[model samples]
Structure formats: C-alpha cells, structure tokens
Target: MAMLNKGDTAALVCCSNGLRPSEKQRIDTLADILGDMGIRTAVSAVMYAASTHYAGTGKKRAEAFMELYCRKDVRAVFDVSGGDLANEVLPHLDYGIFIREPKPVFGYSDLTVLLNAVNASAGMETYLYQIRNLTGACGDRQREEFYRTAMGGSACLYDFEFKFLRGSGMEGIMAGGNIRCLLKLAGTPWWPDFAGKLLFLESRSGDAAKMATYLCQLEQTGALDKVNGILLGTFTQMEEEGCRPRIEELVLNITEKRGVPVAATPQIGHGSDSRCLILGRNYCLNLQGKTL
Candidate 1:
C-alpha cells in the first residue's frame, strides 16, 4: 500500500468550471480539514470553469488541470466541486501523464465523468466520495479513514454493511458509482469491464421505480451479468411518491434473477454520510468484518 508518507502532500483540484463564492469557501474548508489531518495540500483554480458564466474558459481550465497533473510533488488530486464542464475537459486530458505518475483521484457526481475516463484510459484506481467543495458535513473519523485509504497507499479493509435484500456473501474487485454516471458511460469505450466484479452503486433522489429502470438498463447492457455481488448506498433525499415501488424492493427484484448476493443501504452516495470507495480495487463485503 502506498500510504501518505509522513511528509507527503495532497493536491486539491476544484472542478469549479464555475463556482460561487460560498463554494470557494467550502473548498477552503476541505483544504483546512486535510491540513488538520497533517496532510499538505494545494488548492488550484479549476473552480471558475464550472459556471454557465465561464463558458469561454474551457481552454484555460484544461491547461490548469493538466499542469497540476504533471507536477511530481502532487501526491493525490481532489476535486473541489462537480458540475458540467468535466466532460468538456475529458478529451483534453493526458491519460499517459496520469499513468506515468499515478495517484489516487477523488470526487463524485460530475467527477464521475473524470473518474470513469481516467480509469478507462490509464487503468489507475480512483475514489468516489465527498466532494471537496462541501463543509461541516463530514466528520473527522470519516476524513481520516478516507485519506488513509486513498493516500495511505496499500489495500485496506472495506467490509461495509449491506442491508441484504436477497443474496448472501461474495467478494471481488469493486466498481460502479452514481447510477446516472455509470449509465452515461454505457456503450462508450470508457465503460468499465465489470465481469466477475462487485458492482457497488447508489443514487440520489430517484424513487424505486426510477431506480429499477436504471438497473434494467444496466442489465440490458449486460452490466448486471458481470458482477460477483452488489452493494447499495442510501438514496439521499429519496422521494416517497413517484407512482413507483419502494427503492429497496426494486433493487431486490432486479438482482433476484441474477442470483448474486446483494446488499443495500451501505454508507455511501450523495450524502454527508458517503464513505470512500476505491474504483478498480479488490474488496470483500462480508459478515464479521469492517461493516459500515
């Protein structure tokens, strides 16, 4: 495991493509928290590129992020916020540079675009967790654990509780993130090969039937057939009325035919409670272990 060395630093890349002043302050709070954890960090200006007001800054935004990617001193890259421009910067990214100098990358939502692209192109594992542009939500233990797993290089234990909906114990390389993000990459060269892996996923605000529809898409694309198991995070701010079935019940229904061990409501996704998950890394989700 490549742990964060005693004097190592973490580079903060805010995907601000466009950000509010309040958002900037949130990124600063993230930096301060990391600093308190004794990890050195650098806050770059990828923030401005995310706003509708900054449509013309795409070229400059890519250049800035590319520059940070090349810096040897940067041990890891953390995104500040996620919006729309990440896809714009995708084609401009140098995957070869990241491969040559691989480091753990972290962020979610819009960052999902970047994570899937990098993993597809460079074969380096990335993280899907709390965004850097949020404040006062994550606790210290969560922060320390996340950094420890991400920068404290080396495989760590990850046995989070899966409110088992149908199947039982299983283990494999973990993959999958935001439901929409995963679906977006479908049919693209960037879509991950999920065969024989644990396909962990969660979403925000979608009701059970909508969740079922997305899972069906994954199944139609043969994504479901590739997993060794399934783990779901809470659907934050989920609505009760959608003329659809219950979300958890829907998940149980989808995976029942696959007969794969399925777990639900694990500590993850679109909430302050979202825990860190290493994409492309091997993990075990079982009983009597580190159940979240």
Candidate 2:
C-alpha cells in the first residue's frame, strides 16, 4: 500500500519563515495541482503569521505541526518555508506526538533541522525535499514522480543519479542536509548519531570560504571521523556563481583525510531538478556499477 492514498490530505506548514503575501497564490496553484493528483492539502493557520519574520512563535509553530500529525486524514506534513528560524521550533517541538503517530514529513534547506530531529527522535524516515518544487521550472518532471508514488503506482519517489567522488562500496541510512542547518543541532538532544550513517550535505547558498569554515568545525568536533561516508549534493549557489575553490575541493580536502568514502550527485538539493532523499532509510551506492 502507498503511504498516501487517493483522497488523503497533506498538511503544508511553515517551519521557519512566514510566507509573503505574494506567495499565497503560489500555494493555491499548488493546491490545484495536488488536487488534480487526487490528493488534498490543508495549509497551516499560522503559515502567513508574522512575528519578526517567522510564521509565528516557536511554541505556536510546534503546536501547529503536532496538530497536523494528529489528524487522521493527514498522512504527510510538508514544510513549505525555509530560513533561519527553523531551529527555534526544535526546542519547542513535542517529539512524543511524532513518536506515537509517526508519518512521513518532508522539507529541505533550513527544514533540515526538523528532518534530522524527527528521524533521530522518532526513528521515522523523513524526506529531504521541498513540496513547493511542483511549481518550479522542472514541475513536470517532479510532479510526475510525485503523482506516481502518491497514487500507489510506484513504491519509490527517488530517482537518484550519483557518482563516486572517491573510494566506493559505501552505503548506510542517510543523515544531514543543508551544511549549516544540520549544525544547528550540534548541542541539542535532536542531533543525529552519525556513527554508521551516510552523512549527506548540501547547500543552497555559501561560498567556498564559508563552507570551509563549517567543514573545519565538523572536523574539529570529530563528526567527520564518525560517519561511515559522505554524500555531496548540489551546492547550488556556489556552482551557479562559479565560486572559487569549489565545494568538491573543500569537502575532499577535509573528508579525504578522514578516509571516508565520498560521492557526488547534482540530482538533489536546491536545483529545480532535485529529487527526494529519505533520511534514516538504508541506501546502497549502485550507480555506475558502484555497490555498498
């Protein structure tokens, strides 16, 4: 059976930034699209609330998220907003709600905070994805896969295209996302245990120097040495701007020394062509004859 069935409702919430007035129309359009796919959507009441750039206070946002999960008809929760305030909700979230009534929640970028937390807290698979991608330039491609999976025509939503950056035969349950966002969990109870995990990192924005600073911190904290491997997703901004040093140089410079197998995939991250990565699910490297 599919995780979501026809007529099931999906909740769209804002975990970080509030939606601008201009974006409401986009949500309506997305609702129409999902409707055509035989699914329905319920937008969070506080999705447009303004509290100094957040949709609402952390406690309120956390409450709203927990409420959605309690709904019997809602099979999934999709965070449609991203920014700096996501971590605020982390401290306020009721992990017990997630633990007792686990569901597939999806987000990326700053929502990485919730993705990792839900996985670590509840042992449920959370997705690194943006539901809003169905309205982007690559909407046709994204929407097709989403429809197929949502309608129970396919068992998998991810169509990954990855290449070995160095070494091979590395595979494990995935963790990590948005280089900087994952760091927000550093000292928190929500931080994922990277031991025996494939630490996947990506970024929508960040120059080489900024990435290096973050990477050095990862190394210093001994996180680099703990993970079995690292997967590099599209560094959108740096790649598009042709930034110096490049992400590969910075990542390889640090991870290579740790003897961790590394792989690269441009098919994920902030790109319009991006696909989903199910964190906490076992995945093996297989592209180009690579195997775990």
Over 1-292, each residue of candidate 1 has an lDDT whose tens digit, in order, gives 6546655677776553566655666666777777766777766655643436462455666677777767777777777666556666666777888788888788787677678778878989888865442354556556656556645753332334455666557788777877876777787777888888888777775666668789889999988887898877766646435435666677678777778887775567776656667787777666644322
Q: Which lDDT value does model 1 have at 64?
A: 70
* Highest lDDT against the true fold, candidate: 2
Stretches of candidate 2 exceeding 4 Å from the true structure = 49-52, 153-156, 287-292
What TM-score, over all chains together, does every model reach?
0.84, 0.95
lDDT for residue 185 in candidate 2, whole number 0-100? 89
Q: For model 2, what is the error of residue 209's alpha carbon versus the real structure, in angstroms, after optimal superposition?
A: 0.3
Give Cα-based local distance difference scores for all models. 0.69, 0.85
Question: Best candidate, TM-score-wise?
Answer: 2
Clashes of each: 19, 0
> Candidate 2: which pairs clash?
none
